[model samples]
Target: MRIPANRMPTAAAYRPDSRDAGIRRYFGLVQFALIVGVPASRLCSWRHGTHIWVPSPDIQVGDHPGWSMACIDAWVPGGDPFLRPPVVQFADTAAIRARYHGMPASTLWACIGDGTIPRPVVWVDNRPGWLL
Candidate 1:
């Protein structure tokens, strides 16, 4: 049975051990991609392989299906995905510069390159923003 994407649950609503836990508590492909920082198309292109871990949906939701947070968390390299908090807050270079007035951009870059500053959680567009 096809389920509408809108009717699918969000990641925040998922509870791993709840009685209502099932496909209904999972995230659809689009939502999963957003949470995992991968493109939806890349997720779609995955094929079952011995080395690759692919999450199976407990139930179908319309044309899209969902994967449990537990399953996705397991596939992630780190420890308990939900239990971990972001190590730092992210800010753009300009913000960093403003925070450290009088510091040269070159020095800032050098510090970042030499580990004086923490690296970014991820790059948005072409800008590198650090995680606090």
Candidate 2:
């Protein structure tokens, strides 16, 4: 049925049949970055690759790159995934001394006192340890 000219629907009320209401079908650059836990600038840089390896965008609209919701779910950053902090390996004085070729306990203590050796990063079971 044809609507009268005076009853014409406004643009805001128009819904294109091509877009399904089931769920969001696509992710904008900003939205993808937010879900991936990175800044939009970083995403753009990664898409083009700031290093030897770069993640390619899943979809492109015009000159801008985008991703489908499905692709976003599977998205992995260029290096070791995005926003993943590096694992810190903690070792106590004895273990640390072993790493330094078994430096003497007295020498290690002197270094610690003289500020040559950095402070411990964590304490477990009342033992101090440095991050390796």
Candidate 3:
């Protein structure tokens, strides 16, 4: 049976299709920082620098800026993977080495030489790095 209009819940009582309560969901600075794999402190510094690390925010709520998904996708380059930073930044070389089964530089270089593995396709600070 259908309920009468007067007996039905109001629009305000229902969850919005696009928004969380009254506020629209957006990727804020914290979210942007995580996406680019950088410390929020570092992002903050970039935000004020001449070459801002992030594109202009899609929206600004009060004092904070927020980015939309489209904005981020367009800002982050899609071409030349070697030129971009790793999605998860490593603090030291040890962490990166762990990814390749703890293989040392010499062994990795040998593998590339013997055709056991592929050569590095990505460059970190002009030094070619391997990914498998």
> Top lDDT: which candidate number?
2
Instruction: Report lDDT per candidate.
Output: 0.54, 0.56, 0.51
Where is the poorest 10-residue window by lDDT in model 3?
A: 81-90
Q: Using TM-score as the measure, name the better of candidate 2 and candidate 3.
A: 3
Show pairs that collide, candidate 2: none
Candidate 2 lowest-lDDT run of ten: 8-17
Which segments of candidate 2 are over 4 A away from where they belong? Answer: 1-19, 22-24, 50-55, 78-132
Which candidate order results from sorting by TM-score in descending order? 3, 2, 1
lDDT at 115, model 2: 92
Ranking by lDDT: 2, 1, 3
Better of 1 and 3 by lDDT: 1
Please give the clash total of every predicted structure, in order: 5, 0, 0
Put down candidate 1 lDDT per residue, 35-109, tens digits, no spaces.
666666666565234343455553343233455465565655233324332223356677777777857889888
What's the lDDT for candidate 3?
0.51
What is the alpha-carbon lDDT for the whole of candidate 2? 0.56
- What would the per-residue lDDT of candidate 2 be over residues 1-132, giving only the tens digit for each residue? 999977854432322236645432334576667666777788777666655233444433323444545456665665444432233345667876887789998888888889988866543223455655
- Deviation in angstroms for 77 in model 1? 8.1
Output the number of the TM-score-best candidate. Answer: 3
